[model samples]
Target chain A: MTHTDNGFSATRRLILQGASAVVLVGLGNLPFGLAPAFAAANDKYPEEAFKAKSEADAIKALYGKTPEASDKVKMDAPEIAENGAVVPVSVTTTLPDVTSISFLVAENPVALVASYKIPAGTMPSVANRIKMAKTSNVIVVVEAGGKLYSATKEVKVTVGGCGG
Target chain B: MASTIRVRATSSGETTEVQALIQHPMDSGFVKDAKGEIIPPHFIQQLTFEYDGKPVFTADWGGGVSKDPYVKFAFKGGKKGDELKVSWTDNKGASDTTTAKIQ
Candidate 1:
């Protein structure tokens, strides 16, 4: 076993060198590693739709008026979210002649999360999970028969979801 | 890969409706871990509903959405005992299909 110990040591050194080279190459390609801590700050949505902190603010931003809750729109969400990263939500409506459906998170950086255009003769319902930065209200706005109806449910986000 | 997708359809005299929620991780590229690495975008990109092998509804999505995406849509001609199949594909090329009988 000791006959070629010199060769074995040389091979071992070469293998270690190659492994370090691979690691260096991998780290060099990671743009996130090179940038300063402040350089990779989180980007905010450009649209003004998300800044609303209250239900009234969100509604005023979306419809130009504070929304009055009606029985027509129904919003469903967990009372206490175990994980704020993804909170499941569903909105259904019994309103007649629904035309559109939209969802908003009152406290998110941008309140307006998603909006769907329901085609004619189609059901006006949407189910989606949204990111909640904190405990906030999830609102659903429905347009039925050319009239807008809304609903809200308070969702408690115990942990941060937006890369906190 | 051949598991049956469960879909429930209900009709309230005037309109036929169906609702479905699939288990998926709709990762938007914007999400980052404690290490500050940008998590590549992974989201449901395609979804389709079929009734007896006939296409009924289709949807396309982007990374602006959240995780575990849920979608609800309705059709006019669904009836009790009809078969509804739903399938989805994520940005990473992973796919899942499920089906349920309309009741």
Candidate 2:
């Protein structure tokens, strides 16, 4: 009888301990749950409103003005991308007095993709891969000698790069 | 951040060729989270190369690509002492640009 009572008490204690641990974890998560609310309170702008519907929109948002289309910017990409996740891209330019380079995706949220400030006496060239949520035009903008020149290329995203 | 970008420039007579590689996750938002929810797409969309205050190349990209996209190209009239600057931007509005000297 004594042994049976001891076993029962030990089991009860174990259950209580488990319950307390669960309560502690729940309390710990409460702060995390409130974090989003705090973030929303601090947000002043509708961040999604800045998303670009096309490559043009992205450029406008980036420089606060329109960029002139120029042949000097060479945008190399596959006409048809087999995979929507990884597309190889290369951009070369022969523009003189180049000071900066940038890239943008037209159909993405907040399209002004990347920018590079070229130091004096450096070669102006860049290559990289970009993800597409869907089929869209890729745009390149170059700030050369204080003037901005741009180019665009249409890329077809057959498979959804963003989960559909 | 503080990642190494490998740059190689080859010269044949007057023409100079350049190649570069950067370490980036190139995360595609279509991936799933641990709970199987589709993660939003994030990717690099633009890149540019400049040599000695001259724009040599520029590229535009989209989602139908893979992670850590590798790029290679050639240009005419690059010298051995030229500076090659590379920069990129992503869909999330994040940007990074780095420079490599032609060797």
Candidate 3:
């Protein structure tokens, strides 16, 4: 059928675009010729990654690879958070060609806190507020130059953030 | 309804800095209300910032993010008086978008 041929061509084009679009993530398996039209739409949400209950599973779901620990990935977090509901965390990486950064809480019910995509020309630093259920180690992962690096720190919470 | 997003974009010659604060409960579904019933998860799943029609920064968030989330980042090549677009879509499919002029 002619429609089959069109679908094949469209899929090929989508693959090519995915290869070039560093801003997009985890969207390669979307089917149908209509998928390419969505290239301009919002990026696909990683529902599975957010649902991972541990840090290691989350990192694998999001990036499909493991990251090496590195000192260059600097994480700024409070030694003790007065309010667990709004613990301010940030990261700045000295690594080159940084493409993405992610946060994970080793003790939270869902370990993955936040993940960010850094396009070309964007600075390699990001700051945000997150929640911690209790005292836990906060890990930051930086993806740079086709490789992944990470840093971690312990943050103590006086009170629980996920509703004690 | 008034938009729930508040954004400020400032360009300093070479780099542009953006800070945004969004009003949302960001409920992690792990909490209970006064009646002891569980609160279902309601959180923003994705937030994007676009300049010159290209995404400079994008955030994929989970319920672990704080309520009324605030985030900051910077990128190169944004010009003064230009426009930057900020938008977010929550898990329930609710979305809000707004544009801010660079200063």
Off by over 4 Å in 2: A1-57, B1-18, B28-30, B38-66, B69-103
On TM-score, the stronger of 2 and 3 is 3
Q: A45-88 in candidate 1: lDDT tens per residue?
A: 21244345455665565456555689878788999997877788
The clash count for each model shown is: 8, 45, 0
- List, residue by residue over A1-164, the lDDT tens digit for candidate 3: 99999999999999899777843444444455354566444377778899999999999999899999999999999999999999999999889999899999999999999999998899999999999999999999999998989999999999989965
| Model 1 chain A: lowest-lDDT 10 consecutive positions | A38-47
C-alpha lDDT of all candidate models, in order? 0.67, 0.67, 0.93
Off by over 4 Å in 1: A1-71, A109-111, A117-128, B1-17, B45-66, B71-77, B85-103
For candidate 3, what is the DockQ-based docking class? medium
lDDT by residue (B12-56, candidate 1, tens digit) is: 655557776666666656577779898776776666777765555
- C-alpha displacement of A60 in model 2, angstroms? 3.6
Best by DockQ: 3
Q: Write the per-residue lDDT of candidate 2 for residues B1-103, one digit (tens) a residue.
A: 5844566777775667777775655555546878988667665666667777655765554443456667666677776776788877777887777777676
Can you tell me the CAPRI class of model 2? incorrect
